[model samples]
Target chain A: MIRHIVLFTWTDDATDEQKATVTAELRKLPDAIPELRSYTVGPDAGINQGNHAYGVVADFDSADDYLVYRDHPLHQAVIAEHIKPILAARAAVQIEV
Target chain B: MIRHIVLFTWTDDATDEQKATVTAELRKLPDAIPELRSYTVGPDAGINQGNHAYGVVADFDSADDYLVYRDHPLHQAVIAEHIKPILAARAAVQIEV
Candidate 1:
């Protein structure tokens, strides 16, 4: 299995509504993308309150499937429309398991 | 459930043996710590070749359980004895799911 993990820190001034909109849009991705085998997204519980405020973990059968998910128009649309505006920093790790 | 996600980048000069030792030590945590409901650790497949070289995803019943795992002597020992020397950077997100 290939796992793609992304951690995001929202821009300081981004409203709760914007964050909610981004979260809801991300939550819809698994249903829209056939290559995404599983998806999980949530906000940090803030024990440390580090830079990352939210995270998304998704699984794919192979790296190719992951690439497909990454390049999918719907995924791109979400990034361009919802993510970029409020995203402060993003970090990701992709690995086979 | 609370999920603790950590990403690590090994020091450029760190040896393969050191990285392997760290991975093995982390893989043993679930058995050593009863509070660890699940544990997954592995190196990055390097599709993006981003800063993080390895990732760990571990789950617990609650945030308190996660704290126990974090503060456990075994974990602290591992960080001090095995992780800190070869670690370059670390990023994490903890959230209730």
Candidate 2:
């Protein structure tokens, strides 16, 4: 199995309702991309005095599938229209188990 | 709870034996740090078309505990002796859940 983990930090000004929309949009990706076997999205809602904008953990069958998912146009749309503008910085890790 | 996620890429030349030793040492961190709630470490061992060095996901009780883990002497020793010298780049995300 292959896992692609992305950790992102957004601007502090971003609001809760906006993040909820983003989360819903992101969760809908698996249906659009055949290569994306599984998708899990989470938020760090200041419950423990820490705040992370979002975390996306995805599971795929192979790296090629992951690559296809990465290059998909729908993914691009999400990044361009939603993520890129609000995110401060993002870190991604792609590895096989 | 707070989640402290650190993603690191080590130099390509670093050996498996070195990585194993590092993994063992990293796994032992929870024992030394009282606040650490959970620890998970994984490798991107080149199974798929792409390769990643390693991935670490940790769970903590609070941001203060996470901060202490960050500053802990044993953790610092591991970084200085094992991680820092061999790492190309490292990314970390700490947030509440």
Candidate 3:
């Protein structure tokens, strides 16, 4: 399986509502894209300092399934409409497991 | 549970042997630190362009358990002796799951 992990830090101007919206939109992705084996998305737990504000972890059977999720229109729409405007920094990696 | 996700980009001079050592050291953490519920570490699958070079995903029963893993001497030694020397960029987040 391939595990795709993404960490995000929001811009200073990003509001709670915007962050919540991003999470809400992301939560709908698993249902919209069937290739997802497992998906988790949420804001940071605030346990440590200097951590990114949010994270997304998604699992798929193969790289091709990951590409399907990456290029899916619904996923792209979420990034464009909800995530991009507030995104300050993003770090992502896809690792084989 | 708390899922801790960390992404790493290595310095240009880091060798394949160094990376392998880092992975070997990290894979020992779950056994060393009993607090870890689950752990995954590996180099990037290279499926996407511009993604980070390496990634770690670790799960714990709670934030406290995560802190124990974070502060454990064995885990710190792996970072200090192996990862820090080659790390160029790092991004991390801990999210409730």
Candidate 4:
């Protein structure tokens, strides 16, 4: 499986309500991308002593599957409309397992 | 290979110079921990429309090796002195590949 992991940190100016909306929108990605085998998005536990705002994990059958998910229309929409607009800082990496 | 990815976003109050110092400290991790096969840390490109300050990725021989790297004293020191104290938000995940 190939797992794509993304983490976001919103600034203090970015309200809790804003993160909630982005979380809701991101959660809809699995339904939009067939190659995605599993998906999750949630807030950090607040115990890690970091500014982490949220976490996202998605798994695919292979690297190619993950590539497709990366370019899928829904994913693009989220990047452009939601993530691109709201994210204060983000990081992502994909691992093959 | 097992990959451990960690991303952090510093608050606006965090100076670029501060990130540079943390980046330097974090980059020293691989040599300190024998289990860390490879590691990378750097500033986020400003165009991504997010608050992300830096990124860290390290590959391990296996999950057990990753666990060892996780608990290593060098990593703990970096976390306590640099990461934990400076991070506004952070996220991490491990993938077996």
Candidate 5:
């Protein structure tokens, strides 16, 4: 399995409404994309002050399968519409397991 | 369950031997710390240049349980003896699932 992890730090001015929208949109992804094996997304619980504000971890069968989900039109739409506008910093790492 | 995710970027001066040692040391934690329900750690596959150099995703039964692992003597030893010296940047996120 390919463990694809992404961390996001929201823009300083981003509103609660916008963050909620991003969460809802991301929750819709697994159902919309067949390439995903498993997916989890959530906000930081504030245990670590140095942590990112939000993160997602999704598993795919392989790197190629992950790429399919990454480039899917629905995923692109969400990035361009919901995520890009409010995003501050983004980081990711993919590991084979 | 609480999903605890941590991303790390090693210092520029860190050697390959140091990176390998960090990986080996971290892989020993699951058996050493009872609070860790599951753990996975690996190098960043370089798919994304903007991504950090490595990451770890660990699962725990609760926030308090995760803290137990975080502050465990064995974990602290690994961090202080291996990780902290080589780490350039670190970010983390913990969420309830």
Candidate 6:
């Protein structure tokens, strides 16, 4: 399996409503993309300082499956319309499991 | 459960051996720390451009359990001895799963 994890740090000016929209839109992805074997998205738990504001962890059977999710229209739209507007810094990694 | 994900970008001078050491050392943490419910660590799969070099995803039953793994001496040693020396950038998030 391949695990794709992304961390996002919102811009200082980003509003909470915008952040919530990102989460809501992300929560709809598993249903919209069949290749997703597992998915989890949420705000940071605030257990530590200096942590990114949000995270997404998605699993797929193979790299090819991950690519489908990566380029899916719904996924791209969420990134373009919701995430990009508030994004400050982003880091992502996809790893074999 | 609480899922803790951390992304890392290695310093330009970091060698393959150093990165390998970091992976090998991190693989030992689940056995060393009892609170970890699940853990995955690996270099990026290279399916995307401009992604972080590596990622770690760890799951714990609760926030307090995560704290135990977070502060574990063995885990800290791996960071101090292997990762910190070659660390370039890091982003982490702990979220409810």
Work out how many backbone clashes candidate 2 has: 1
Cα-based TM-score, every candidate: 0.94, 0.66, 0.98, 0.54, 0.97, 0.98
User: Which regions in candidate 6 have their CA more than 4 angstroms from the true location?
Assistant: none
Q: Which digits, one per residue and each the tens of the lDDT, describe model 4 over residues B1-97? A: 6666677767767766767778788778777787888775666544224435666667788878877887888888878877776678766655444
Q: Model 6, residue A89: what's the lDDT?
A: 92
Docking quality tier of candidate 5? Answer: medium
lDDT of 3 by residue, B11-77 (tens): 9999999999999999988888889999999999988889999999999999999999999999999
Query: Which is the better candidate, 2 or 5, if ranked by lDDT?
Result: 5
How well is each residue in B1-96 modelled by candidate 6, as lDDT tens digits? 999999999999999999999999999998889898899999998999999999999999999999898889999999999999999999999999
lDDT of 2 by residue, B1-97 (tens): 7766667778879887777777888988989998888776777645444334777777777778887888899999988888877888676666555
- The candidate 5 chain A region of ten consecutive residues with least summed lDDT is A88-97
TM-score of chain A of 4: 0.88
| lDDT, candidate 3, A1-97, per-residue tens | 9999999999999999999999999989988999999999999988888999999999999999999999999999999999999999999999999
> For every candidate, what share of the true interface contacts is present?
0.58, 0.31, 0.97, 0.08, 0.61, 0.94
Model 5: per-residue Cα lDDT over A24-93, one tens digit each = 9999999999889989898999888778999899999988999999899999999999999999988789
The better candidate by lDDT, 4 or 6, is 6
Question: Which wins on TM-score, candidate 1 or candidate 6?
Answer: 6
**Per-residue lDDT for B5 in model 6?**
97
> After aligning candidate 2 to the native by TM-score, how far in Å is the CA of B42 from where it should be?
1.8
Clashing pairs in 5: none
State the fnat of candidate 5 relative to the true structure: 0.61
What is the DockQ of the complex in model 1? 0.68
Per-residue accuracy of model 1 over A1-97 as CA lDDT, tens digit each: 9988888888989999998888899888888898999887888888985548888888899999999999999999999999999999877899788
Residue-level lDDT of model 1, residues B1-97, one tens digit each, is 9988888888889999999898899877888899999887888888985547888888899999999998999898889998899988878899778
A1-97: candidate 6 lDDT, tens digit per residue: 9999999999999999999999999999999899999999999989899999999999999999999999999999999999999999999999999
Which pairs clash in model 1? none
Which stretches of candidate 1 lie above 4 Å from their native place? none
Error of 2 at B78 (Å): 1.0
Model 4 docking grade: incorrect
Q: What is the CAPRI rating of model 2's predicted complex?
A: acceptable
